[model samples]
Target: MDYRVAPAVRIAGRCRVPGDKSISHRAVMLAALAQGESRFDGFLAGADTLATAAAFRAMGVAIDGPQDGSVRVQGVGLHGLQPPAGALDMGNAGTGMRLLAGLLAGQRFGVTLTGDESLSRRPMARVIGPLRQMGADLAAEEGDTPPLVLRPVAQLRGIDYALPMASAQVKSCLLLAGLYAQGQTCVTEPAPTRDHTERMLAAFGWPVTRQRGRVCITGGRGSLQATQFSIPGDISSAAFPLVAAVIAAQGEVLIEGVGVNPTRTGILDILRAMGADITLLNPRDAGAEPVADIRVRASRLRGIAVPPELVPLAIDEFPAIAVAAACAQGQTLITGAAELRVKESDRIAAIASGLGMLGITVETLPDGLRIEGGQFRGGTVDSHGDHRIAMAFSLAALRAPEPVRIRDCVNVGTSFPGYTVLMRGLGLEIEEA
Candidate 1:
């Protein structure tokens, strides 16, 4: 689907985005590993997360209703999953495929995991190398991509490994696999990443410890007990409207119950540093996660050199941040984010191409993009089947001199379903074409 967005004078509304995709995936996986029924509220009803629920069902676990902010998972014990009848399809979810690969590594039966073209192109060697060290019998495509073949391993030995990059997926994959491995498993990251995995583990009654840059877990111990909890709204999703409100002519948007986990709030920190008038209101705990109401109003934003240390923290929000940069004063330089090249699309190149198509002066770097803040003019841009690219450009329309059309945007459903509807509600003119 293609999305057309027209310039808007103002945006005003109170909105709640879907559950955090990371937390939603973990909630389902951990709940399915528990021995009893677990009820979760605010589950994200998106294609990626639904793939996870379907995979669990194929393994003989029963999951009911992701209907209207709730899901009930009847977990099979840690040792109870049956070999799936055929290949497990993860759709567009890198998170689902990588994390599930680790969870299935120690099972007695073999399983094959596959995904859409985009996911199949993503590198799986990061997880493959670590799992092999833990003694997992695994194989991948020639390029170390998808169609990963995980054979049964009689025993998994724990190891103290260091991450070459700061990745929550790799860390969580190892930790989940650690649950079935023998001895203690420790993963040290070069920098801080999202802690949703560690937080959700504790919520499920499995204890983990984080000291400095490392997270350690002891495996082959107690079973995970089922628990009921609610997931906080995704801050990643809120980033669009937050940026939209900041760049709009006159607007105030109140986003409710957004997860403000310190590690994942890099976008917020960066926006504030760039002089956005954003406030966190009525902060409280939502289960093991922190939730707050975010109030954002239109402000004359000035470009600043984004701190390199916050790169991993705000990695996912860079596309939206690029939109803010396009409309800010002066220039914005984003560095230390070579990881952007390997996402669903080559995001570094994709962002530069898309923004350039809209008449913004963007220079593509080997690792990042240098964007000059100015006015956005209407034109057509390809999303390259990237959800963030599509959504970011749509927000760019708020400041466009004419309507902007984003193509190949059907992949938006992979993360934020009904994104067009949400944008339309905020007084922007958006339509599917």
Candidate 2:
């Protein structure tokens, strides 16, 4: 499928994006391991999250109704998960696969994890190396990619490991494994990544300790207690329309109930640095995460040098940020984002190529992109089968002189199921093609 987005005269409205994908995945996984039935409101009923739910169901956990963002997960306890009938397919969720590797490592029965083509190519060595350090018998296909196979280990011994790079997925994977390891597992990160796992672990009644740049958990020390939670709106999904409001010629947009966790607010900070008129309203706690309503108005954006320290925080939202940069008044220099190359797609290259097609001057770099602010000339761009790339370009259409056609956008449903409808509701001239 493709998306054909036409120029918008105005972008104005109040809307709420889907629930946070990362939190939804963790909620389901941790809930399944808890001792009672846990109910979740505002869950993201997207393909990737549903895949995680399905995997748990395959292992004999009963999951009901991700309908209307409501789901109920019956906990089977940490040691109660039954062996699956076959290889567990994670679809396109790299988060699900990596975290599951850790969660399943200490189980008595062996398991295999597979994914769709895109996920199958993502590097798994980061999680694998840490799991190996804890004595997990895990292996992957060549290039440390997926088709991950694991064998039962007599015991998993926890180790204090430092992350070579900041990764929430890797950190969460190891911590999940720590739940069953023989001793305390401590992970120190070089920089802060998302703390959803740590927070969710604590919410599930698992004891997790946190200090500056470090999180530690002891194996078999506590059991997960099933608890109810209401997931906040995904800032990553809210990013596209937020950028739309920034670059649109006229009007304001309010995105309500968004997760504004400090670690994941890098996108807002970067856009603000670029002169985006964004504000947070009604700030409050939503379960274990922070929630706020974000208000943005059309503003004259000026591209600025993106700080490297904020890279990990805004990692997933860079694609939309690139669109904002393309429509800004000056050049935007992005660095310390080498991780973008390993995402669902080579985002740096994909965005660069897409912007170039729209008559934007973009210099592709190994770690990032040098994007020049300029007018967008409508054109067709391939999404490289990446959901973010597809949505980012759709937002660019708000500032285009003509319609923008984005190819290979079928994957958008993996994260945001009703993207076209949601964007259209906010006055973006978008539709499925």
Best by lDDT: 2
Clashing pairs in 2: none
Q: Could you tell me every candidate's TM-score relative to the true structure?
A: 0.99, 0.99
lDDT of 2 by residue, 1-433 (tens): 9999988978899999999999999999999999999998999988899999999999999999987899999999999999999999999999999999999999999999999999998999999998999999999999999999999999999999999988998999999999999989999998899999999999988888999999999998779999998999999999988998888899999999999999999999999998889999999998999999999999998989999889999999999999999989989999989889989999998999999999999998889999999999999999999999999999888878899999999999999989999889889999898
Name the lDDT of candidate 1: 0.92
Candidate 1, 257-363: lDDT as tens digits: 99999989999999999999999999999889999999999999888888988999988999999999888899999988888988889999999998889889999
Q: What are the C-alpha RMSDs, in order, of all predicted structures?
A: 0.8, 0.8
lDDT of 1 at 220: 83
Please report how far candidate 1 places residue 38 from its true position, in Å.
0.6
Sequence-dependent TM-score of model 2 = 0.99
For model 1, name the residue pairs that clash.
none
